[model samples]
Target: MEIHFTKMNGAGNDFVVIDNRSGIYDDLTKEQIERLCDRHRGVGADGMLAIEQPVEGSSSQYRFRYYNADGGEAEMCGNGARCFARFARNLTTEFEDEISFDTIAGPLVATFPGEDVCIDMSDPFDIESDIELSLSGTPQTVHFMNTGVPHVVLPVADVTAVDIVAVGRELRFHEHFAPAGTNANIHHVIENGHIRLRTYERGVEGETLACGTGVVANALVHHQLTGAASPIAVDVQGGDTLKVEFEKDADGNYRNVKLIGPADFVFDGTISI
Candidate 1:
């Protein structure tokens, strides 16, 4: 089968987007998705986004399905959603400042303030603080939350110096988050407004250049710790920068969470299955 695909990236996280409005590959298999995102054998991306038709009265502009490199479906991806928005705009002439879509998790909204795409990432909840864990015979504290998906944030004095693969891998599958493992992140606060982060994504099973949801997770954790305000600038493993903004409710929870960053077109082509 010859499938038409568009390759895109947001800050460095890449995706293979297919306009499956025709349902040509409706019965897509986990193996197929894994092969498609295989860096050595297939299109090579962090994940794949399929633009499916919105269900009746969904109150959404469209529906997007996400698949991880491991062929697992994801609830939400901050960077991929931004790339999804840009890819959606490219497919239709009805361009609007704001675009809304439905995911497995729920409905989401995206907007273009400039060249960068900003997504209203919805509310974050299920916060667990000071989680005790044993790493290398030492006890450490980690913070956990769900911003569309589950993430565990570890505050380190030096992000780059930390062994992300080892620690992140251990924590991601830790007993605390058993059954469905969590994405792990190590972050360093540069100051009140800036932070550096590195993530070990669950589906990707390794660190990528950037992660949109992870960025929001780290920033929100910082806010809870330091009373830092919104519009926090985050520096990812990739050289590019991303911005996260949100409004806190009276209950000390975060809502109106937004992730702002660059989503750029890389290339497009036809690949056979």
Candidate 2:
């Protein structure tokens, strides 16, 4: 198949954006998606996105379907959504200030505020216990939460000192949580007000340049621990700053969590797979 796609990035987390609104593409096998995501031999992306017709009874114009580098489907991705919004804007000749799309996570609102893409991420879910995982022969205590998707956050002393590739894989395949695994995020509090971080996404299964939902998960955990204010800034390894904001209800549950970051088009091309 000949695939025409736009390469986009959000804070260095990249993806291949394909417009399948006309239903030209059909079900893609996992091997095909994985081959396309191969850095050296393929298009080289964290994942692939298909902008398709909205689901039944959906109010939005389109829905974003995301597949990881491994060709596995994911419910939602913060960075991928930003790139999807930006790519959609570039595709349309009509000028639109704001846009909305549906995903497995439900309705999403994206605003093209000047040059950046800001998204109204749905409320986080599954805030649960903190546990210890054996990684690289060391037992590390980690916090698990789902900010749109499940994430395991581990507070590290030095962000770069941890071997994310090895440890992340271990935790991603841990027997305790088998079949469907979770993303691994390691973060360090830069100061009382900021966080520095890296993440091993489940589908991508590597340290991405930046992760949108990972930032939100870490920020929420930080807020819970320190009682910080809204709009927390996170410095990701990709050298971009992601702004996170949320509301904590009287019961201390998170609501209205959002992620704001940079999304830009890198290039466009066609490839045969």
Candidate 3:
């Protein structure tokens, strides 16, 4: 079957978006997703997204279903959600400055501010210690938080020196996280209250230019450690700066968490299966 898809990117993490509200295309398989994501042999992308009609009275009228290049469905994707919102808007030409949609992680709301998209990410779960494997016989001091998806945030002295591919794989597959893995993020605090980060995503399985939710996770972890709030700037390995805003209640629950970053349109085309 042949399908029409849009290629989009947020920061640097890219995706192939398909609109399935018409239900015209069914029978999508993992192998097809993988083939389409092949960088050299096919239309390469980090993952694939499908836009479906949201259930009645949903925060919005579209539901985003995401699959990694491996064809496995992920609970949520921060960067992908931004791309999904943009794709949906363009598909219907029904643009809204703010949009709400549902994902496996629950309802997500996003707002377009100027030329950027900011998403209200899920509140984080602050675990006292690393629930999974610690850093290679090192102490278990990493902060655990779930912003859309589970992430292991490790503060480092120099993020650049860290081998993200190797260490990230180790943590992502740690037995504690089990059958389903988690994304790994390495963070370093830069000057003037900015944090630098590199993330190894679970589905993509490598470092991308930027991760929307990963940036939010890093910012929240930084705030937990440093007690700073309001807004935090995150420098991603992709060389883009993502701004994060949140409110910490008296009990330290992170609410009103938002990630602001660039969502750009690369180009669009149709493909055959």
Pick by TM-score: 1 or 3, better one:
1
- Per-residue lDDT of candidate 3, residues 87-146 (tens digit): 776765465776778898889887888888888888777454544445688755576778
Off by over 4 Å in 2: 93-95
Consecutive 10-residue window with the lowest summed lDDT within model 2: 90-99
Position 143, candidate 3: lDDT:
69
TM-scores of the candidates are: 0.98, 0.95, 0.93
Ranking by TM-score: 1, 2, 3
Candidate 1 regions off by >4 Å?
A: none
Task: Point out where model 3 deviates above 4 Å.
Answer: 56-59, 129-134
Global local distance difference test of model 1: 0.91
lDDT of 2 at 142: 79
- The residue-by-residue lDDT of candidate 1 on 1-273, one tens digit each, is 787899999989999999998899898899888999999999999999999888788978789899999999999999999999988987777867788899877899999988899999968888999999998788999999998889999999998798899999999999989999999999999999789999999999999889999999999999988989788999999888899999987987788999999999999998887
Best by TM-score: 1
